[model samples]
Target chain A: MPTLYIDLMSQPSRACYILCKKHGLPVDVQMIRLDKGEHKKPAYLQINPLGKVPFLVDGDLRLPESAAIMAYLCDKYSLPDNWHPGSSSSSGQAAAHQQQQEQQRRAVYESAVHWQHLNIRAGCMRLVFHTVIGPRVFKVPAVPQVAADGLKVLQQALKDMESYWLGGGSRPFLTGQQVSTPDLLCVCDLEQLRMMVAEPSQPQLEQLLAPHPIVRQWMAAVRAAVGPALYDEAHGKLAAAVARLAAAAAAKPAARL
Target chain B: MPTLYIDLMSQPSRACYILCKKHGLPVDVQMIRLDKGEHKKPAYLQINPLGKVPFLVDGDLRLPESAAIMAYLCDKYSLPDNWHPGSSSSSGQAAAHQQQQEQQRRAVYESAVHWQHLNIRAGCMRLVFHTVIGPRVFKVPAVPQVAADGLKVLQQALKDMESYWLGGGSRPFLTGQQVSTPDLLCVCDLEQLRMMVAEPSQPQLEQLLAPHPIVRQWMAAVRAAVGPALYDEAHGKLAAAVARLAAAAAAKPAARL
Candidate 1:
């Protein structure tokens, strides 16, 4: 059985957890509570020298980085075809199943994966690194402008995503007719970006994810593919846990929030 | 022929130019002349909404990111055999590439690509963006500290590169015995870093590319396998450039020392 070291509050970690559990991959869920600095512990640090969570340990082999890990596992397990249909990439052009075959092919989907790599992921990560992790690790205040810039990039990324995913793309998913590894990646990111703007701009995202028919269709397809219960469960894991803790805090007003 | 908009100073653009000309890919170089603000012209902006340089136009298919452009070309023209050597991935122990026969299957390469996508690439880019490009584009002062921090990450990345490139793996190359797409990607990056990083601090780098026995041996192997003259010319395009520019600058009394 592979062991997955996870900190659920971290979105990518949650992404791995959701998929692994959904696919029923043989994975041992070892909790590395990032907020509590458990990942920095000597024991955990020995596993992942970099001290990041959501790393996978199988036997003597240890793997880090979400995209690599996701790809590694998917290619390994032969999970359901929709996740990443092997034959699709083999001879692809347009979306499969009329599935807007063009949408599914080497252009829009592939470009989106590469595009978000630099723009969205980097931008979102900068926000978390500067505002959240840097302060926690280095006692430095998040440079206000840096965080602002990160959000601005996020907004533009959303615009690009909306353009491709809804505006032009025919597939219900970001890539096309079916979900690929990118969807797994985006689920984690978008959940973290509940607020598209500096504040909780869920309204803006709601429109992008729902009202935008393509995205709305894609979301439904993704939810259906991933399973609605699992999707909601994965999305709400942190929220539910946070709400629970908050309730406990309210029950005892003197307790910490 | 595809039209490529590029700025000479841009690293990715430089890489694209080198790959195209070196491989003899049919490409029409549309010099964006970034130094003169041609990239920001409305004509170029219509092609790439970002108004960023290094946009590629193949018929109506417009791609902005370098990764996207590279993938497009690689897919379009069936590239050389060694370019994207199939790697054993995702599949666990059941994965059936014979270890001995599986010449290109690599172990550490997965994390290498992962790190490139996440930490190394993003870190260096942020450093470049915030420190170098920020000042160049926005009239801000170059922040040495930011570059230094980025350099630290780059240094570690190079350290990892040295370990893996030197280490015998599935392929003698970065991914394996075969020089895959990442090898090209990595070589370009390493070459660019030679120009960017200070000389004294890059002692290991100098040694690796120089008289150092084992390291130089590995570098030679990379150049030889990747095609020495082509590699040299690809890199030399920039080196001769620096030397000539250096001589010209030295001749100018008004130039800052």
Candidate 2:
């Protein structure tokens, strides 16, 4: 049994956990206490000298980084469909080997390519850029233009991805639908945006998500499938953090005056 | 033939080009011509609306981001031994399928893990912060503190990577001592550092190379393998860019005074 290490609300970490549970891959969830900085401690560093989360530890193999972990797990357990898009060959013979290799290559390529051009990364990076380094740290009014710029990048990404996945005649997940790793990625980050951004109900926000009805529908399905209970459990802490941020904003001298 | 839609100087694009060349993958180089803002043209937008460079078109596949490209190529090609890690499988059925699915998962996870840690990122970001944004845009003095801070992150990453790879171990790349994707990643970014930072041969720079004698040996090997002429060709532009920056700074009236 592999020991799956994570912190629920730490976007990428949550994605890994959700997928593992979603696919019903057999694993043990070892919560690395991020709030207490257990992730930074020496003991955990032995597992991952880099001292980061979303790492996996098997008997001999210890891997850190979510992508590395995802790769290791996909190869190790062989999940259903979406996780791995490229490589892997079941038939050892030279005949199918090329096709298998092509599959693996395709999977790796798809994941990497879509990541840069997808709304999942686009919206997520914007949220991170703003909330993580925005007015809070840089003390700017509407955050920096970089935050807006990040959103623009994401907006373009969403448009591109929507066409590929949901914009088409058929439409599905990030990689032509079918609810693969990319879809989960979108939901994981989108959930964060839904938690972070002020109005999820507004038209501009909806416009960002408007292109692909499949994405919208899939988002709803994913929220339902992941279960509203776990969804809230996973996102509740992040919500509280947002609340604290809002409270702090309210507590400011200008706000009080 | 695959079309590589790219601007060669961009750091991520450089990572893609090196991986393709180093692994001996064939690609048709298509410049997005950043200087003319050609990336924003609708024709290119049809390919990648985000307007970033180093997007790859393999047959019908269009992928972006260096990390994605590397993953895609590694998956698609026969590949050099160290491009990916782990033993090759004999059981084609289970092993191949598992590997394909996880490849994307790992790509996402590893890049995230590596970037999240301040080690290499801190240094790279510090350089961008100090040199690109700080002194240049933000109008801070050539604050030794800021540059020094950048060096610290660089040092820490080098120390960690060197100690791990600079060993009497089997593999000889950054992660395992053999040339893996991470090795390609490190070298690409490190080459930029050599130019952008002053005093390339400084001890802190060497200290990063020191812990791993294997890494040092491997660096020589990568240099040799990559060919000194090509290595110089690739990095030569960055060197010129830095010099241009310095000359422009010198030409400023305030500096003249």
Candidate 3:
């Protein structure tokens, strides 16, 4: 079995973990605590010099980056095409026409993945780090200006998803009617907003997502496809983190000397 | 023939253009002048919606994002496997061992591409935009603080490339000894720093690159692999733009009446 080194608190790590679980691919899941800086340790760096989570080791292949890991898993396990949407026949005898069709599907899928990396994921991760994780977990001071800039990018990304990717609900998911790796990658980042609010109502996430109903619809579809059990399990650590932050915030005034 | 809408001034556009030229792929290269807002115009928006340069149209498929465009072109034209490194045999009868090796290569390639998107490409583009393009072309005021932050990112990216990706010149190219799409994508972004300095001597580019000798060496290999003639042609417009910027900067004091 391949070994997946990840922290569920990390969005991409959770995405990869859920992907494996969703497919019943038996693999060892090793948690690398980001709070303790385990990812940057020399041992982990030996395996993955990039020092990032969601590192996959299958035989001699040590792959880092969630997008690549998910892609490799899909191909290796022969997951449903809808989940990734672009695998040529292993028989190598796929007709030219069918191969062309697969190429187009693969290209569309790649476009979504690339777009997510630079836009949705970048924006959301920046915002969440500035507002929630950095302040609460790392004790890093939150810069309001940086957080504001992050919000702007996040908003633009949400708008673009509604207008371009979803095409005003014309497509059931980002690339097509089925949820793919891009959807998983993006939705996980957006889910990080759950930590943004002090209250459990998650007003911040709602407010940001309200105008982009199509994005909301797409998120619902992706969550449903991944199934509630595994999806919630994937986000369990994040939920706990958010609760801890909320509790700390609530106790601050009452405990003051 | 497929149509590639691009502006050579755009790094990814030039990368795609050069890839097609290198492979002798018959492609219709159309210019979309970003300075003139051509990419954002309704006609172009109708096709790409993402409103980015290096948009490719092959038959019914309309692909955006440079990484996707390059990958699709590589597959559609059946470019050398080393250029991409993970294409499965079309006959699909390859042994499991060979297929596994290809998957590993492809995974490594994907990791490089993903890393470039967020690290090297992001840092270089941000720095260039704030210091060079934004002030010069868009008439947007340069934000020194943002430029400083961009420089930090660019510097860290260079260091990471040297230590992690290049492994102190251990590997010839990003993924392997052979040149691939990640090399093209990253090298083009680094090339943008040429527009930063005012004098003929690109001190800014040189100074930024001086510490990371491995990255510089890898860049030389990518350029050699692409060959000078086509590579020069691909960067023609960017060179012209850089010249214009230099001329404008030189005349700034004298033009003040």
Index of the highest-lDDT prediction: 3
The 10-residue segment of model 3 chain B with minimum total lDDT is: B84-93
- Candidate 1 per-residue lDDT, tens place, A1-257, comes to 77889887777787788779788888888888876788888999788876887798766566776655665566567565555433222332334444323322545544665566656676676565555445644466666455655666776676666674544555566765677767766666766544233223223346445534554455566667788888787777566654554455356645545
Task: Give TM per candidate.
Answer: 0.73, 0.73, 0.93
i-RMSD per candidate, Å: 5.9, 6.3, 1.8
Residue range with the least summed lDDT across 10 consecutive positions in model 1 chain A: A195-204
lDDT of 3 by residue, A107-164 (tens): 9998999999878987887677767778777788766545655677788889889998
Tens-digit lDDT track of model 1 for B1-257: 78988875666676566667656898999877765677777887677767786788877577776655665565565565455322112222434645312222322444444456554465555455455355644466665545655566666655555554445332355554565555555556555544433222322245434432443454566677667777776676557645654465446655655
- Residue B157: error of model 2 in Å? 4.4
Give the winner by lDDT: 2 or 3: 3
| Candidate 1 chain B least-lDDT 10 residues | B85-94
Pick the winner on TM-score between candidates 2 and 3. Answer: 3
Residue A118 displacement (Å), model 3 = 0.6
> Which segments of candidate 2 are over 4 A away from where they belong?
A86-88, A92-109, A112-160, A163-170, A194-215, A224-233, A236-257, B22-25, B85-171, B194-221, B246-257
**Which structure among the candidates has the greatest DockQ?**
3
Point out where model 3 deviates above 4 Å: A88-90, A198-203, A250-257, B198-203, B250-257
Q: Which candidate, 1 or 2, would have the higher DockQ against the true structure? A: 1
**Model 1 DockQ (Cα-based):** 0.29
The TM-score measured for candidate 2 stands at: 0.73
